[model samples]
Target: MDVAEILSHHILDHHWGYSLGGVELPITTHTVTLLSVSVIMLIGLYWISKGGASTLKRLLTAGAEEYVTFIRDGMVLPNMGTEGKSFLPYFCTLFLFILLTNLAGLIPNMKTATSNISVNAALALCSGGLIVYCGLKFHGIIGFLKGFIPSGTPGWLVPLIFPLEVISLIIKVCVLALRLFANMLAGHMVLISLLLMIFIIGQLSAVAGVGAAIPAMGLEIFMTCLELLVAFLQAYVFTLLTAIFAGSVIHTH
Candidate 1:
């Protein structure tokens, strides 16, 4: 069996059809999953904000708001400070969108969108853009550019340090993208490899396949549970780091 081909079937984008946009583009599985996640989040936000009248509805809404509150109180306020309150919605949306997409992968026959580097990079770009915006908003263009150089730096070192700082900013975004994509991809790869072993061994001998099945299934189950936790953890980590980075820029000297 071609292991690489199997992995790509699961990991790579599966195009369902071509969309006639400004240019023809293949609409892939991730596109549908992401759009679904977006719709769900919007409906959830409306339900949370509307404050449904029924007792059941109210309880469910409260539970939903608790997660949103965690982002606001736990992540944003502590890291980004009260000044970051205005952007609470953006952070909340980011966390929830990621959490949903991550969780979706656990469903049978479904895949995680965040496993795609392009998707993760797009997310990082959004966060990076926000960081740049915060810098420009709080400090003017001159002040923002000057913030890269430290207060007591020597004149000669200023030029060297400035370029490094700019490069550092770009690297931060790349890191965010790579971190999420790699983490998600790694977990799924492990899980996929475990299951594939059963099929590969089965071809050699029935008895061997049966023996491998027990351990392979056990590991797959364990990985699934671990992946569930990872889904939430990755979402939180990305959101928290973004807030911290934004906070740093906002409070820069």
Candidate 2:
């Protein structure tokens, strides 16, 4: 099989359908990975909550606290201020869920759900909905609509600027979805391409393939380490952007 096909198998969502009477249920690899991520988060939180006397448990709890603090002080509060406190659970959950999903793909033979645009779009929609809700909740319907128009635009200019502002709002959320999807998907594809080269070269000459293995393996390790950093970075960026966007509508200052 070509490298593209191999990459697709690892990155694309695989679906299985079951029919009972006329009803059909479809479960995809993304479904599995998302569920797995959820379970891991639940278990991690439970472990942290049900504290143990062991050193490992203490370290784990400490790390979890740091994550929460970082998201609160670093991402949420800075963007949304006191209004953000209510959404801490959501932003924290988003970060952890995406972090686990990205990290899961690094595991041998496991799929990354966020690699799918649909999954990321679903997440984007959730954040977008919250943004709109917050705008309306604080400003009321007319005020929320007015927020789209800049405070200083002239009447004739507003007609043009208003649509652009709405479009910009939409593009921001779209970026949230695409940013994570592209980063995770591209990182994995680069890794696969590097590894694939060793095998492709192997087909030419056994000795040449062996020669290729050293650099390919080395690059693969380096890429994996880089991807590990990216996994965390993408999660942080998504949460930070979400907070900023939500903050925009919440404060409008």
Candidate 3:
């Protein structure tokens, strides 16, 4: 295969589906990764429920419990105050879902669902929807929309302010989607390029490239560790931002 095909294979989504009524319902690698994430989460839940006295089981439960508490107190409560408790379930699910999907990319032969732009966009939409829903629930449509306008604005600037605020809200959701999609896509591309370098160099001088591959392999391993940390960090950042946005909409200003 040519370079373009190889790169596309690594970067693009793959579909596995049959045509039905001339409309294909794709079961892409991202779909499989998402399913895997759900199963992994279920397994984590099972481990927590087992309440086993084994060291590994206890450690898993402890970690899960700690993460839940962290998201609750550190993220949800601080941002949403007493009202945040209502969203604990959503916060946990979002964090764990993102975390699992992010980590899944590191596993051999497994794809990253969040790397898909559509998936990231969908996630951002969900968060944006929640923010809007909360705003509308707390304040009627008119009131909720009015919160977008700055207080004490000049009447002459009313038209500009309203449109700007609405645009800002849309931009927030778009930023959330692009930030996540870009990060995941860039990281994977970097990893793939690094590995590909070994072969590219080997094509010219087999001995030199073989020697270089050793250190390259080591760097790749280091990157794997860093990627693992990034997986957690990105998940936390997304969850934190969603909480902040939700809180902002739920309360005026």
TM-score of every candidate: 0.95, 0.94, 0.92
Cα lDDT tens digits for candidate 1, 1-253? 9999999898887987676766657578888788878888888777767886899788978887797788899999998788899889889889988989999888877779999998999999999999888889888899889988878989999989999999998998789889999999999999999999999999999899999999999999999999999999999999998998889888886
Q: After superposition, how far is residue 49 of candidate 1 from its true place, in Å?
A: 2.4
- Give the distance in Å from residue 44's predicted Cα in candidate 1 to where it truly belongs: 2.6
lDDT of each: 0.89, 0.90, 0.87
If ranked by lDDT, best first, what sequence of candidates would result?
Answer: 2, 1, 3
For model 1, the superposed segments whose C-alpha errors exceed 4 Å read: 19-25
lDDT measured at residue 116 in model 1 versus the true structure, 0 to 100: 92
In candidate 3, stretches whose alpha carbon ends up further than 4 angstroms from where it belongs are 19-25, 50-59
Instruction: For candidate 2, write residues 151-199 as lDDT tens digits.
Output: 8789989989989999999999999999999999999899999989999
Candidate of highest TM-score:
1
Colliding pairs, model 3: none
Spell out the clash pairs found in candidate 2: none
Model 2 TM-score is: 0.94
Please name the candidate that would achieve the greatest lDDT relative to the true structure. 2
Q: Where is model 1 poorest over a 10-residue stretch in terms of lDDT?
A: 17-26
Task: In model 2, state the lDDT of residue 116.
Answer: 89
